[model samples]
Every structure is written in C-alpha cells, then in structure tokens.
Target: MCAYQEAGGTDMKTKNQSPRPALPRTPMTVERGVALIEALVALLIMAFGMVALAGIQSTMRRGSDQALQRGEALRLAQGEMETLRDYSVLSAEAAASGPAGTRAYAGVVSAAASSAGGNTDFSVTRSVADWADPVVGQEQQQAGLREVRVRVQWQDRAGNEQFVMLDSFIARADPALGASLGLPASTSATRRPAERSVSIPVAAKDLGNGTSVFVPSPTATVAWVFNNMTGVITGRCTVAMGTLNSSLTAADVAGCSNNTVGYLLSGVVKFSSAARPDPAQPGGTAWPLDVGIVNSTLNGAISAPVHQCFDDAPTSAANTMAFVSFNCFVEPNNGTPRIWSGRLELSGLNLGGGADAKKVCRYSADYDGNGSVSNSEHPENYNAVSGSLSRQNFLVINATASCPAGAAINPENGVFVNNSTVQQQPR
Candidate 1:
C-alpha cells in the first residue's frame, strides 16, 4: 500500500511538471508577421520625418528667394542714390520744357530707369529755402541743399511689402565758388574780390584753340569793366512765346529766348552781338549753373560750382566747352521724339571733369561749331575736367577777374588744345 501511494504521488508530480509541451512550439509565420508590422511602422515614421524635412526646405527656399529679391531692389535704390550724388545741376534749356515735356536731367534719369527695367521711381523738386528746414534739428540758415530721394519697394513671396529708401543731398551752388545763394556777407568778404568785368573786350581773333575772346587779334589792351550791379539771385523765371515767326537770324534771338537777370555779378562774359551775343546760347547760359532742382524747395536752392552765361552766341567758337550741359529744358523723348512737355527734376551735379568731357565730346560734340550737346554723357567727364585745370578740356572760373590783370584764361598754364574731331551720335 505504502509503495503504491509513493508511485502514484511520483506519477502525479511527473504529469504536472511535463515542461508544458514546449510552449506549443511558437509559429514562425506569426513572428515574421510581427516583424513586418514593426518594420512598416518604422518606415512610416521615417516617411513622416522626410515629408516634414521637405516642407521645411521648401519654406526656407522661398524665404531665401524673397530675401534675395529684396536685396536686389534695395541695391537698385541705393545705387541710384549713389549714382546721382554728383549730378544735381541742369542747364536752362535742359530745365526748359520743349515740345517734349521732359527736362534734360529728367530725361537722363528716365533713360537710366528704362535701361534698368524701370525698377525705381524718380521725381525732382526745387526749393529756394532751407532743405532740412524749419530748424528741425539745427539753426535754419539758407541751407541750400538739393534733396534727392529714391524710394524702392517690392513684394515678398509672402505678399508682404518690402521697401528701401535712399537719400541724396547736393549743393546747388558750391560754397567754394563764393556764389552760394545764402552766403553771409562776412563769408563773401573773406573770398577774393571778383574781377571779371563785362566791359572787357573779347578779341574775336582769339577764337579756337581754347580761347574765349572772339575779337580779332591785336584788339589792343582791351579793358573789361564790371557794371557793379548787384541783384538778388531769384529763382523766379519768366517764360514767354516771344516771336516764334521771327526769322531765325541771330538778331531775333533776344526776343525769342528767355533772359536770366542777376545783378550780384560773380563773373562777366564779354561778347560783341548785343542781340545774339553767343551762338552756343544754352552752353553759355546754362553751363555749370546750379538752378535748384530738388525734392523740396524748402531744402533750398540747388547750387554747385557751375558756369553761367549771359549771352546767346558763344563768345568764341572754342568756348563750346562745358563742364555741364543740358540740351533743352526738354528733348524729344518717350521712346520717340515729339512735342512733349514736362518740368525738370534736378537730381545731381556734374562734378568737375575735363578728361571725361573731352573724351565724350570727341564722340558727341559733333556740332561743336553749330550749337551745344546734352550734358548727360557721364559725370566722370565732369570729374575729368575737375581732375586738373591744365587738361585743356573746359575751364570755368570761380571768381571774377579785372581786365588783363584780373583775367583768367581756360587751359591755363599746362593746358594744351587739340583739333580732334568730336563724336556726338551713338554708333
């Protein structure tokens, strides 16, 4: 009985500890299926990550492109501002409204804008008062600075407005010339007395080869005297249709053209013909003049070291040289030439230049003996003239001179003249 009971107990214990039938032998198929599910989930996660990365890259690219565009536009505006700093003055003819409505200086700016794909907007206004005036920050003096503003704007990819502004200030009359509009009397006293007298006889024989007088040689000890007349340099100019039907003879020129009146004489030019004293009328009257062309008249008169002529005909044929020249108040324009009319927007000045002027005139001054050419060639030409007075291109005196003793001649000293042909038309 005892043995039977022990055997039974042992059999029961063995049956219970049968190793659980090796856990029913796991199915390889199920394991593989599970592995696939895990792999798919991982793949899905990776795909989501890739999609997010692509979106980010696309956004970044668009932003970058917009930024690039803005940068280019800003650069355009800044470049325009920088480019105009040296050319603020315009000739009277260039300042005049021709059959075409554009002024010489404005035409130049427009041409530049067109060539640049019209990426910017330009406008010019003149002022004879304080530019930064009303004494916003400082004392209100004559403050004759021509303010030029170039505003640039564009849309970003996000449809946001982007803009950049460039500002330029130019002096209509350079203080150095002693002809500044609001110059104090004390300052004028410090300057050397002007000696250019209108009575000085200009020898016609002295024409050509860098000479001003047209008087025949040996006009003998000609004496030039100043009228000693002084008048306010008013910006007001009167325009009239004097005698259009009159003959084109030099005699009728006086009645047909606009006259500039100023008594405070900085310099005097002597010419023979009272009716048509100069053939290069604009070249003589408008050369180097800083009649205000600015954004705000309050910014003051546009002044720069410029040449002014009181006559219609050139004193001498050689006097065709101009540091700055504007053909007409307006020229044939808008992709074609017709009687268009518009006001002038003086923006910059033609800094001193003879070398560049000489080079350009060589190509553009074709009608050298006939009349004047536009001063829109290049400011570098002005710089060339300013580089040295001895370059023999064009000479503008800063102060008046007395006859003989006070006389100042262009191409002074080291200047040499050449009989080279001028080029005006484009190739």
Candidate 2:
C-alpha cells in the first residue's frame, strides 16, 4: 500500500474515494408543493367562514329592525284606539258635545300622515259609524252605538308596507242614556219580527181594522184603520195596485186610524216601473224613489242590519251624486207618546265620498212633526227596535194621544177598531 501511494494514481480510494461512492444519490427530495396547497386550502376555508359570518350578521340586523318597526306601529294604533275610547259621548250624529267640536264622531277620515311634517313613514286614519247593536254588550240593551276603526300604517326598512288596525263599538253618551229607559232596552219594545209586505193589491183608500202598530192582534185599547179592501186581494201584507200610486193602500198595513192613515204596511212592492226619479216633476204628490228595505234577521229575531244603499247614498239631498237614503227610527217611541212625531234616530253611510253630502229640507219621505213627510221617513221600517213607521201628511197618523177617539198606547196585542160606519171593514 506504501509503494502504490508513491505512484501517480495516489490511491484514488484514499484520495478521492469517489466522494464516498456518491452517497447513493439521495434522490433530490422533490417537494410536490404540499405546504403551499395546505396554505391555500386553509385560506379558502377561512374566507368561507368570514362570508358566512357576514351574512348572519346582516340577517340579524334586518330582523331586529323589522321587530322594532312593528312595535312602533302597534303603539300608534293603540294610542288612537284609546283616544276614541275616552270619547264617552255617544250618538255624535245628534248631540255629541253640544257644540261644533268633532272629537268622537269626527266621521271617517282619509289616510293622513300622523307626523305633521308629512313623513311618509307613518299615517293614521279613523272611521266613525253609527250602529244599533242589541247584542253587543252583555245580555241585551237598546244601545245607540258607533263603530270606531283606527289604523296605523308604516313602511319597514325593506321598503315593505306594514299596517295595524283597531276596531270596536261604543255606546251613546247622552246624559239620559241609562236614566230614561229604566229597564235598559225595554223602552222601544217591538214585535219579535217585522211583518213582510203582503202581495195582495188593495185600492187607494180601502179600509181595515187595527189598534196600535204593535197591538194589531186580539183588539187592544186603541182603534186604527187599514187599506185591506175587497178588490185588494193580498190580505195580511199588502202591495199597491199600481206603482207610484198616491194615497196607496194594500192589505192591513199595520192598522189604520179612521179611513185614511195606515201603519206597518210593508210588503214586496213590485214596482210598475223601476222606481226611478221623474226629473220632469220636481215634487209631485207621490214621487217615485228607488227604495229598498234590508231587514237582516237571524233565528227569527230582528237585529240591526246596515243597508248598503243607505250607507252609500248621500245623507244630504243637495249632493249631485244622485242617490239619497237615510235610516229613520223614532225616539221615545214607547213612552212620552209623541202626538205627531218626536226626535228621530238616524245613522250615516257614505256621508262624504266625493260630493258634499248635505241634509236638505226637500226630502221624499222625511217629516218635520207637522204630520207632513218632509224631514222624516213615512211608512219606513228602518228602526229594528220599533214598529213599522207610521205615514205622515197624506195618511200620516199620530203616534200617541189615543188614535182619534180615545185609546191608551199599548205595547201588547190589540185591534183598536171601534164601530166606525164610515170606514168599517169586517172586524
């Protein structure tokens, strides 16, 4: 080994040793970018989480805002309803506060911004209507009621419109509401149900027998006449021989006083013509009017039914809208004994829908206590608590003070036809 070392080769194994046989070439430890891949994946997952969190946050914010807005709208509606509750006074159509102040019975109003600045955000409106509800309260009472509707509207953050409403009924606040009647709703006693109009046709001035409007059976303490003549076939309930017939009489309309006046003569009136106004005649003896009666009944008992036509017609005759109808009922009907007629109970519908609905003196059936049909509805049965209306002026009879001869006002059954040879018909 020493001699070889002196040679030119110089022991390649000891000198170079081929770099220790190249260490088998470690294979260069190639990397497939796994760390970078892991980093990218982690970044993507983090981005997804951030996006989810952001969405959740936005949804929560919107939900919270919506809840808040709804609460505010509810509060506004409640406040308005409470204000109406405190009105106390009832029947605002007549005497709500004695003066011109319209607090409770301010009538219905259009949607007006509650905020004086006209902030389109919130608006408030009220609807006041006259109603006679018998079963509204506990048990039964003749309550002059008014329905009040309060509405509050708003827009949510999402630009969606939202609203709230409050509806309820209130009674009359007349100083003598509970005082005058004594027995609650017993003051204006009426028959269980109104008699439907008869189909028979009676002559214009025929005669029949009856007592008071209520006591038409069993002959009571009063005497009245009727128009149930022989030629007038449909007895019981009667209709006119022709449409627009003046001094018309049908079967035993309620009863009649003497040979002229009749009461409770309601039946289906098959109009000869469609009962339209005759513009050629301003105010004739019997002007035709498109009148219809809607007496809503449930289980054979008469409850107050609001007529659509009456509600839609103008309260004032001067309105240019063309139609006019008013609900009419007699106050103090059973007591006080109105010799002619007393104050009337009235309601309003469609009072102001475009035209200025006004109450004019020139009416078709309205009477002003002069036994004349001017301000009152004669032969009208709008009062669910009273008998069919008595005619005025042309056959307008008296409500109290003994029917001509001498008779006490009886609410029970009776046919007050004494022996009158002039207009006596088979008692």
Candidate 3:
C-alpha cells in the first residue's frame, strides 16, 4: 500500500508542474519578419522597371512617326518640282514668264492618315524668277536663265510643323529663240552709235574727306538726240565750275587751310521711262537708258575715264520701261585740297514719274599721307570745313524729269546726261 501511495504522489507532482510552462512559447523570431519585408521590396522594384520600359517603347514609336512625316513632305516637294519642269519645257512662254510670282497650293491630307492608307495633308508653294548669268567681262544682264523653287510643308505626329524645299534652273533652247522673244540677237547687236551732245553748268559743295555734293543750277542744260530710223541715241555733257566760295568763314579757312589736291568721284546714273507709252511715239514701247562715264577731268586733268553705254531692252515684249547703269565721275579744284579717295553709287534717277530709287557712297582720305584714313585724318578737325566729314560719307540723290517732243532730251528714246562737279576743302 505504501509503494502504491508513493507512485500516486509522484504522478500528482508531475501533473502539478504545469507541463513545464509550455517551453515559453519560443517567442516569434525577427529574422522571419525580415525575410517577408525583402520579398515585398523586390516586387515593388520590378513594377517600376516594367513602367520605364513601356515609356521607352512609346517614345520610339513617336520618333518613327516623325520620320515618316518628313519623308512624305520631301516626296511631295520633289513631285511638284517635276511637274513644274514638265510645264516649263512644254511652253516657251511659260518658261519665259518665270512664275510671275509666288504660287500657293492647298494642303492634301494628314501624314498619319495617309500612312494608314488614307488621304494626306500637305501644303506646297512655288516661285519662279529670272536668273541672269553672270557675265565675266561686263556688268550687263544675260538673258534666258530662269530659277524655280518649290516648298513642301506638313505637320508631324506630335502636331509640330515641318517643311522641305527644292531648287532648279532652266535655260532658253537657243539664241534664236531668245531673239524671237524680243531679246537682242547678240551682245554686239545692242550697241549703237553716239549721235548727240550737251553741256551743263554745275555747282558742288566739298564735304571734305574725298566727298562732295553736286547742286545743279537752273542754267544746267542737257543736249540729246534720238534717231527713230535706227533706234540709236547719244549725248555728251560737261560741268564747269571756276571757283567755289567756302561755306566756312575766312578766319576759319585760313586756320585749317590745305594745299590744292586732285580727286575723282565715280558712280552710276540710271534712267527709266514711265510705264505709260508716249502718244507721239510710233510704237507703244517703254524705254530705259544707261550711260556710263565717258570722261571726268579736274583742273583740265583727266582722271580715270570709263566708256560704257546701255540702252532700253525689254525683258518681256509687252513690258515697258528699261533700266541701265552708267558709270560717271567728276573732279574739281577747291583751292585748298588734301588727298582724298572713295566710291560712289547712285540710283533712282527717272525720266518719268517713278519714285523707287536708292544711292550709296563712301569716301576716305589720308590727310597726312600715312597710307590709311584714320580718326585723326577726319575733315571735321579743319576749320575750313563747316560740316562734319569723316573717313566715310553716304549720300542719296533724288532727281526726276519730264520732256515733250522736240525737247532737248527724251528718255523714251534712251536719252539722258550726267553733270557733276568736284571741289577741295581747306581741311
């Protein structure tokens, strides 16, 4: 009984031990939580990579669309150029007209729409102009060259504007063909014999530094002649000035006095007739005249003499009014002169009512003979020169004229003249 009782006490003690406190539940480890967090971060990174790849693909597609649009614009421009070439070759009149100006064509369809086998939206523009071949020896217009330009414009996939252009040249078939179109038979055929003469008095103000302004008096006269039978015209002019009163005071002139020196002033004189034809004139023709410098002298001494002449020749048969450029110059003894040299350009001298004219001239001087015109060589430093004249000066000449039949000059017959004077300043 004692042994059985002891066994029962041992079992009760084991049971009362509370099953060893369940091993404290092992307390959940931090390492397992860390592994789960790392998996979630990897999934987030993969999602970002997929999004970036999708964006790259979209950009590539846009680039391809842009390229396709540009190619289509170029093709359209080329096609228009070919069409113009064919039309120009088919008609001599069309080629001679040279587009008359800029012509615009309507837009077709969008590039994206056209790519999908639909219509295309592209605009085209064309322009034609007369192209003169640059002659080597002379400054004269060469007939029969034409320039053609074509432009193509369109929009890209991104709605950005795009454009392409093409250029081409066309020439006359033959010299005889040009002649039939009212052009000169040859370069020599346009030359005519000089047949008239004139003399005019001129007054000039020496601005100093190789520059001067010519002021024509009412006494100035132009003697000209026109031969209707041969369509030949000619004229000669002379401007003489004995002495010019200085614009500055005597004390000022003496303080800035200089030695008498020679100079040459050169430029072009152009003449254009009115668009309306003369009533008495046999043919309803608009004539233009260009006379070059024949001879210019200073104190009875000839400087550089240039002999060139140009006459009115119509670009188109129905077109009236002609354009010509004549080189000219003058020399004067202004009593007190210094070394001077420069260039002159004159335009917009019309025989009729027309106002589009321009002139540009520049002059510089080496007063000390230092081989270059510097700031110290300016004429403003001299008291004799009232107006400020520096190393360069530009002047614009505006002159127009009207003449009737039997008048001393008639621009319709390609008749005109230039009278100029040169002077020296004390500075």
Q: TM-score, each model?
A: 0.31, 0.35, 0.30
**How does model 2 fare in lDDT?**
0.36
| After superposition, candidate 2 runs with Cα above 4 Å error | 1-32, 91-102, 106-111, 116-120, 129-143, 173-427
Best TM-score among the predictions, by candidate number: 2
- Give the distance in Å from residue 325's predicted Cα in candidate 2 to where it truly belongs: 38
Pairs that collide, model 3:
109-120, 109-121, 110-121, 291-326, 292-327, 293-327, 332-422, 334-424
Prediction 2 TM-score vs. true: 0.35
Looking at model 2, report the run of 10 residues with the lowest lDDT sum: 418-427
As a whole number from 0 to 100, the lDDT of residue 89 in candidate 2 is 33
Candidate 1, 35-126: lDDT as tens digits? 78889999999999999999999999887876676677676776665554433323336446434433323222322231122332332222
What's the C-alpha lDDT at position 287 in model 2? 17
> How many Å off is the CA of 250 in candidate 3?
63
Q: Which ten residues in a row have the lowest lDDT in candidate 1?
A: 383-392
In candidate 2, position 403 carries an lDDT of: 15
Q: Tell me the spans in candidate 1 whose CA falls farther than 4 Å from its real position.
A: 1-32, 88-90, 94-132, 136-142, 174-427
Give the range where candidate 3 is weakest over 10 consecutive residues by summed lDDT: 418-427
Count: clashes, candidate 2:
33
Reference-based lDDT, residue 272, model 2: 10
